[model samples]
Target: MMRLSRKAWNNVVIISMLLMIFFFNGLHKKLNTQPVEEGVQALLPEQSFILAMAFPELKIERIGTSWRSQSQQETTWQGNEQQLEQLVELWQHQKLTIANLPVSKISQTSADYVASVWLAGEQLPAVYQLYNIDQQYYLLDKRLQRVFELEQADAAKLFPLYPF
Candidate 1:
């Protein structure tokens, strides 16, 4: 039997312990790190001057904390400023990722809608397409890359209809 010397065994144990510590440290970091969307800057909710959503049947807009909707309804629907602000904040801080599928190839359905966020002085708005495919809602950037997964209920809140 080729038995290792006591000193040799001690060295092996120390090396094993060091490797285990490193592995755990790496795992801890991986678990704790926030999932941030790469290649995109965080959108500032506070700096947003206008928000709009366009659908095949109607259009909704929020300007300076006031909400208006143009549809077949006789009265324009108004929204709560506090709720709208919170929604903006939620979108600003939500974690997103680069889509695995290309935006051009994303299958669109009849329920899809286009949303835009405009900064204080920007001539063009940052556009996103919200799609409901197979019951899951996805938010795709203007370039057609899927950026965020959203709940259907939350998406509905963006275009609430006021009961006449």
Candidate 2:
């Protein structure tokens, strides 16, 4: 029988382990990765302005050219009409990256918040659910069942009053 030195035996064991790893790696099934859709897609439909936004904490309504917020605690928001208008505009025209499937298919779990927005000319308000998965923000439209992945800054822009 041919005998090998201690160093040679160690090298052989290491090489064998490396070969096994490479073999298993090659045989492993690859994850089906969907290409990210890149674009500035509008968060809300065009020409749609929120006439009213109802959250668990507060309800904001459009009064004439301005807006007002009344809290559930029977308190009112201190922000003026300009701030309300800016909030409306952010909802109206904010662009976000639409979260693609299988994330959309998988992330239909419980939401942190569910809010309703009454848009102009719409009798029924559109419902939206906000979710946080792995520290990333996602907004799901209950009506359309579409999920839009939001950036950290965009989430802040959309919900300035709400605590996350």
Candidate 3:
């Protein structure tokens, strides 16, 4: 058997501990992050940055790092900067699932509110139809032919301009 001095043993233990820390750190990061699942996509594609979002009653646009929000019903700015920025952040990170509800689940009575987003590099703005049915919220992307279901809180965050 190889014999080691006390000093050598201490150094070896520290080296092994460091290797373990590094290994576990890498492993933790890999485990903590969720794997991308099929049929799940970001609300806004990361490649394109959003320049503005115009809902039925309000419009918010990026003015450098800050944002400008104004009422569509009127020309006055209604919401504060912090709220507008949070709305932008939510749109940037929120993920949407491809809705699989049956046709019968959603009736025809739900009134649709339109939300338009102007993205960077796209000449035409992307438009989404928002709906609230039985307190559940949905955003439909007509171009993609997909409906994304959202929770009530998230729906409120997306369309705070409205009374909903």
How far is 97's C-alpha from truth in model 3 (Å)?
2.3
| C-alpha RMSD for every candidate | 12.0, 15.8, 12.3
lDDT by residue (1-164, candidate 3, tens digit) is 87999999999999999999999999999999866555778887776788998977788899998999777686333678987888888888888876775434544545467788898988888877777776777887755556788877877777676566
Query: Model 1: runs farther than 4 Å from truth?
Result: 1-77, 107-111, 143-146, 157-164
TM-score per candidate, in order? 0.47, 0.67, 0.65
Q: Give one digit per residue, the lDDT tens place, for model 2 in 38-106.
A: 555676778787789987877889888789988776433456778878888778887877786444553
Which of the two, 1 or 2, has more TM-score?
2
lDDT of model number 2: 0.76
Model 1, TM vs. native: 0.47
Worst 10 residues of 2 by lDDT: 29-38
- Report how far off residue 82 is in candidate 3 (Å): 1.7
Q: TM-score ranking from best to worst?
A: 2, 3, 1
Q: Who is ahead in TM-score, 2 or 3? A: 2
Candidate 3 is scored at a TM of 0.65
The list of candidate 3 runs beyond 4 A from truth reads 1-39, 74-77, 102-111
Question: What is the alpha-carbon lDDT for the whole of candidate 1?
Answer: 0.58
- Tell me the lDDT of model 2 at 61: 96
